[model samples]
Target: MNFLTLPERTSGRRTYGLTSVIDLGTPIRELENILSDYSHIIDIAKLGVGSAYVTPNIKKKIEVYKEYGVKPYLGGTLFEKCYYQNKIPEYRTYLQDLGIEWVEVSNGTLDIPLDERLTAISQLKRDFHVIAEVGSKDSDKEMPISEWKEEIKVLLEAGCEYVITEGRDSGSVGIYEKNGNIKSDLVHEVMKDVDEQKIIFEAPTPKQQMYFIKEMGPNVNLGNVKLNDVLVLEAQRCGLRSETFYLGERECRLLL
Candidate 1:
């Protein structure tokens, strides 16, 4: 047996493994091809932002994604938009009608009060798997680490299956600095209070992905991955193509 194969490769469909692609505007056929070839390695595909609104065959798209064993959900921003327009109940019903089992609850763009957010979480839990996001879209509106930690606990208590750290599409705002890098100390503090298994780090950059895999290990849950980077990110997690192999070896040496 090869020593390289000593550790069984981490499987997909894992809540804390591999890539979660964000589908901005890929043609349905192209999306199907990509998922068919790489679905075993891609955990989730998010119809990024409001892309779901423009897709004519939303049900067909969801069915194709589900056929490949990939979980698909509308972006958090879309959910916020629905909530702001006072169409949340309709939104929830519409998604249910579309056969969507997962939904993202976030207030990145809107100022949803805590009570209302909790209510949404509680109600959505009855019909769907809820993934709530913590953090704001505005770069200047930084959420205090203490507040983030508290909110994570509250959301989890209110029935959220996973809590995502906001990184927008650019990964420059939210938990990251203006330079598009994760604030390691802040991540460390957040991890201290929240269960890493239930926390999805929105790491869109390779450097940020490497940082999280190095700092939090390969099994750390990552989100907002670009559609093209699914295979690359999976390779990183498996130590097949990334600096993570060296990092893991160094960690082993340190332990020894």
Candidate 2:
């Protein structure tokens, strides 16, 4: 358990290199166990799409996360669902009741107008800390890189706390191909125009995560991480695992 030699990591808070884990209705006992062991590394627990509405004791779930110092919020898809159903006002009021502060605004599934969606970002920012998602969820409906960059700029300017590069939980949409390969060219161009620190790359796969960690350093914000992979991610970030083991001291040795 001694990680004194490990690569340094910031405490789990609203900080850089943040790890956002998806709370997929894990049993309370199991959830407690995991949190007890790793909550320090977990920044946010996103109640997966529509889960906050259906999970038993949903409010208690949020309390459990907070008790462990892990912030919780509903997924962006759920926000889109409420917005499409004409219940955004009701939903927004209910968020405070649920004790979650991080709000996600996305148009990945619905046909929301670009101006209206970005305007919503501005409106929502007035009340909540928003994480705006930029990119279509449909793999076939790819947006041009130039347009994506502009959208991210507009969202950030609209008061979004961070821009989520839509790589859905499946790792098959948004910034990734259907096979989970990253579109490096598109990502590089977007990063050139946007602040790398303000981005939370949707990296569901190990390779995808490593790609960003290697490119942006270990603390680059990453999201849609499965609940169980929190520690594994810490390992990769510290080069304690194979994928990034070379990152540990290879350069130091080379310099020597």
Candidate 3:
């Protein structure tokens, strides 16, 4: 069916308007189905937390994402776990053996100081594309907006391809409040101070997703999206969903 052109979303292995989906040990066949149907919109497939450490047919799953042009990587949580276990050397070797190229260096759960985290990103940069994550997973741990801006800027300088603001898979903590609502002012402040292109906001819920879409336009990078929500997010990106149906309106574009 022919339809009006939707707002132009970045196409072909997008650098923006990216949807980084979480894969929590989806069976190989099921993963294939998702990629076959929505690979065009799926930029990064993260094996959730430490699922990559235990998922069966792990290599095949990574290969499937690559075959469909979707970059796959282990979750930053897994990297934190490896670091906590003092097995980073083995972890790097494991990723290398699997032929994975992208990696997330996060301190969401751990209390690795800023300097050490930057050092890790610099060292990891030698072997893989690094995407660092900021913000604590603990909702009570409030970080000043100025610090958020500073960390994001420095992480980019330290060789991180992008820095993720942590709104976890549960839609609580980090960029969100305890009840899962966005800290809109904080989001705005960060955008004003940092490179929006290199910041991926982890919006795991439909409401949070729409908020980012409306506030940042369709090309704002998003992360921790559920596998099933890929097409839904794409629909919203193109103004196909009711929540953002007016996105194609000239008034909306003017706001951006």
Candidate 4:
């Protein structure tokens, strides 16, 4: 068998595929410039946290991102903040008015009840493609791997397009250790309970990205990617570079 000609390589867009970038504070001009060059390789662009509130030109940014066929949306932390402040209805209206076609529902910061979280997912789905996030931001309050897996099932059943495994922006907590390495045993446990296609791992480092690609393949959905690293990450995903591509190839060879 040709080692590089794996059937898994044929997966299409918006599936369990590669290179989702996080726009933590990407200026609209810079975003436009980058997208003009590399939008085809990027899958999603998240307007991270409350950074979307910083500019009066956010709607214009959303328009440009969408124009390049990139699905842009509010970060989960922003949603959690809105929900906590009882601004959810207003939040939904604002997203709709801004022409945002996707939104994230997460309980990373706040103590939202599961049912309410599910309800928010349902409501968001009526107007936008909803992605839900599991796991807590607080390292001390991390949910067990088993619980996270089960919650993924619940979210998918309730119509969430995908569930993000919380790694926060630092990648030093949640599923990752203080040193930024993933707890592979916990990852293995979660993998047993959900389809990997329905999950996006929040990997913010090159090492973390390489780890997931090596263990879960190139199609593993990754988030919290830095804006400047978008092309670099895409190169890793497509085997365009030797550093990260080496591990990706090893994993693909094993599959073969």
Candidate 5:
């Protein structure tokens, strides 16, 4: 560790300042390599969408995450797919069979109503640590802050352990614009009444990750992080990187 003083942060079982990475088709050997080296700062590992269906030895993959102290979860899209096809019950069995204890409940692209979604969380929370994702994934479906606030509160109340603001895999949609900039005003308005600790902002891009660290402090929950960038993001959180050097006690002045 560096000798310079950085912002105070919590380690292990993070509630507010947490990092969740997306395992989008990570091969088993590569997955082993990344988790072995970079799992210290990671809190959760999401098997993105149906990638788990095609990926070999998913049971083994989940075991890898557990061995590294990182909880594994199936993406909400998989849940949506199952529920849409009248197989939510089967989906539960599948996850249980694999011994996964974390599950994401989201309605990003589904036609399911808000009430049903909340009910699902209420029930799912009984068996797994629920990570509910709120917000539309449609790039054109812009939601007002008022709706975001109400929906987040309702989901949390329904027993979700955490709520993720959808940024999609591309970092374009929900909480972020197509150009990958955060909708800061919306976030401030929501955090005004909602607890920031229960919310995870999906920031797939470095700039977006840095913005959340600056805005919500180093411990703000961030998700959808790529495997290779785990340490880079951690460095930013501790002001070890140039973008957030101002966060440290040491003076950092940019020169032209």
Candidate 6:
């Protein structure tokens, strides 16, 4: 069972090289089946938006993720929903009761003031591992690279274990243009300015994932990856795919 030398990657509960999968509404049995085979590559399973609020057997689902060693957290949009309704205290209590260890602090949709967002990050850091999100979900609303860097810096300082660049599930906002093109210049600027290890770029599409992998190597943290694309993305990360063959350490004799 000889294997080709693939691109280097970290495994076993990694922090930097993460694949944060979005769970829209996968049934518990289906989730278990997928995790049974592919849990090794999955780092985080984010129950998208407010699905956690209405999901039946939600605790059992969280336990499934935990058993597989995948950190499960509610999406930032749910945080926004709670904040909008002025129920953040209730949200915290609910998360604690659910035994959820991770929290996402984001204000993508709501106009939560900057100071308040940072305060929330700081407060949540005491009881949970916070992953704050930067940038807006709105395609037309773009934050300048300078602002992005500053915001990322402060969020990390405020106690966020990681900061997600909002490329939304649609892959047509935040880091990506409305046409789903990566804002290459903006990406490069932020990469140069921020600590790349702490940034999770939300790359939902294959093309976007390819761009980040090419630019940031195999260890780039990516989020909003679809469930089915997990294996496909892992293949690309290891250079098993044609698009990323150049990333392999050992040259292929066929090409030579």
Per-candidate clashes come to 0, 1, 0, 0, 1, 0
Query: How does residue 234 of candidate 1 score in lDDT?
Result: 69
For model 4 the local lDDT of residue 230 reads: 73
| lDDT of each residue in 52-79, candidate 1, tens digit only | 9888788899999999998999998889
Task: Give the CA lDDT, 0 to 100, for residue 119 in model 4.
Answer: 83
Clashing pairs in 2: 17-219
Q: In lDDT terms, how accurate is model 3? A: 0.90
* Per-model CA lDDT versus the true structure: 0.84, 0.85, 0.90, 0.82, 0.87, 0.90
Worst 10 residues of 5 by lDDT: 247-256
Error of 4 at 29 (Å): 1.5
Q: What is the lDDT of residue 215 in candidate 1?
A: 81
lDDT sort, best first: 6, 3, 5, 2, 1, 4
What is the TM-score of each predicted model, taking all chains together? Answer: 0.93, 0.93, 0.96, 0.90, 0.95, 0.96
- Model 1 TM-score is 0.93
Residue ranges of candidate 1 with Cα displaced over 4 Å: 1-3, 6-9, 250-256
lDDT of 6: 0.90
Off by over 4 Å in 3: 251-256
- Runs in model 4 lying further than 4 Å from the true structure: 1-12, 240-256
Scored against the true structure, residue 54 in model 2 reaches a CA lDDT of: 86
Candidate 5 lDDT over residue span 1-256, tens digit each: 7555667778977766889999998888898888788878999999997788777888998998999899999888899999899888898899999999999888898867889988788778888889888888898998888989998998888888898999998999989888888898988998998889999999999999999998888889999999889999999999888888888453322321
Clashing pairs in 5: 17-219
